[model samples]
Target: MTNTDPDIRRKAEEIIFGMWDTLTEDERKEISEHLTIEEFQKNEYIYKELEIPKCIKWLISGKVKICKSGVTGRDQILRTIVPSEIFSFRAYFANDDYLTSALSFGHSVVASVPMTIIDKLLHTNIQVCRKLIKQLAIELGKADSRTVSLTQKHIRGRLAESLITLKNSYGLEEDGYTLSIYLSREELANMSNMTTSNAIRTLSSFATDKIIAIDGRKIKLINEEELKRISENG
Candidate 1:
């Protein structure tokens, strides 16, 4: 199901506006007027590679993954976004089409604020500008860290790290062990930088080791400590 409540929209806008502390009441209202909310189903593309981005999208709820296709049509998951995070800003700043595509991991809601509005706000609000700079720096750091982790870590380490990353990004279900988001094996493989068959094999190994329990798309962490140890040691 999709979210269409006016109250939710207002709350999402308010959260964004709060980040731009330098904006006046009129300015906030002006920016909010240009914002639009969109919903995407599981595996739906928010934007595709080479598409010219005209808006900055803020994930309001659910999860999305940004990915790029390799030379052989294999996907490499670059990053995952959770609620209240802004994306598609790189395209706006670069004045180019998107380098990667964003897809909803599940039913998701996002707010799209026009690039023109963002540009205007940046020019008029020093606090907003500072916040954007800080966010960019943090993103760069994360990219660097992920690059090192993906290359240096072993397959088991990579898989364990991927599981922890997913848990952090989406949280736990009501049972407190099952992952909140369910991804297909291919998606999991892409996220872990492995082939689908390899991912399946590794998952089976993890299950046999009693590190995790899998029931179709549902993954429950049975031994979080051991998982962390493997990820750290490798």
Candidate 2:
């Protein structure tokens, strides 16, 4: 949290204003003046589970995975966040520590806004408080849906849904099929709530059926309609 690059600052402001439009000129200026920009390398830990929240982070670019570790040290991915998304807000609002660990999937730039400033704004600004509540509600709904998808879906359906979710969250490349972000097979399994071997075999089956094409870590959707059908059926 030491950089002051103008481009990063501009993107941070854009994300804040886009999400919460009620900030006054003074409030905006105050935020801009106090914000700190930090760069994290791929696979870097942004925060660990049970750590106290120091700042609210807005991901300006790259991807981050929120995960929790089991007793055996296995990781379960809770959510993947992309640019313009805010993290650690829930912990700050609850006056508690982070429940999950956040890690950078790739080299990422994050804007760190002090919790003190956020708390002050929430106290004085009703609009900001309302926006935060709405955001939290939406996140909760998504979590519920994700839990159902992972627990109830079959192997094929679970993998397909995971791919669809990734595409929707990170978008597709210029080809309109390949995912913008590349994840390893193990990571995909973690996201899908399945074993890595099951994920790999299912992916192979999908490839054989021409539903998807895999090039190392990159997956290209070849039959999105069929994929969606399997997801919906299961």
Candidate 3:
């Protein structure tokens, strides 16, 4: 939904207070001055590859996908951003243009804090810098794990891992079964490092085996243990 500037700033304040407890009042106030909220439509580009990284982006609501295009013109999804998650600042730290692109996986609300302000804070607030370092490390570890899985796992295993990843990110709907996020097979294939045809066939196979129940784009995880075993074995 839409809200007034004051409302948005209040939300921004709440988010900062919860996440950045180490920041002093003065620092928080200054950072708030540079904060801006943006609304994005599904599939809208948040940042394109090679663009100068100017700000740190936080997803306040909905989902986002970080992706890079390959030599064959296929896009590979690198990561998914959930609510309250911070992303897109690593490129700024590396002092380079964005290496990948970010787009809205669905309609989303995002908050941006300019890197200039962040740099000033980083110089003054040791705690903030440490927090950022830890965050980067966690992301690096996940990336490493994903690399191994995609390179080593068979198509079924990769798709299983992708489903588990989605479940972890969004959880289940009120029915306590269906995946909360709805994605097309092409998007699922991109995230799982497979072709659309493979994704479709594997999904059908999973359904036939009673491992999952599919309702168009909605996939309900019916047998998570079997899925995990497949992922582990592959």
Point to the candidate with the largest TM-score. Answer: 3
Number of backbone collisions per candidate: 0, 0, 0
lDDT against the true structure, each candidate: 0.89, 0.90, 0.91
Model 1 misplaced stretches (Cα beyond 4 Å) = 1-4
TM-score of every candidate relative to the true structure? 0.95, 0.96, 0.97
Give lDDT: candidate 2, residue 31: 87
Best by lDDT: 3
Put down candidate 2 lDDT per residue, 132-199, tens digits, no spaces.
Answer: 89889999999999889988989999999989989999999999999999999999999888899999
Q: Against the true structure, candidate 3 has what lDDT?
A: 0.91
Candidate 2 versus the native: TM-score?
0.96
Q: Give the clash total for candidate 2.
A: 0
Two-way lDDT contest, 1 vs 2, winner: 2
For candidate 3, which ten residues in a row score worst on lDDT?
A: 1-10
In Å, residue 31's CA in model 3 sits off its true spot by 0.9
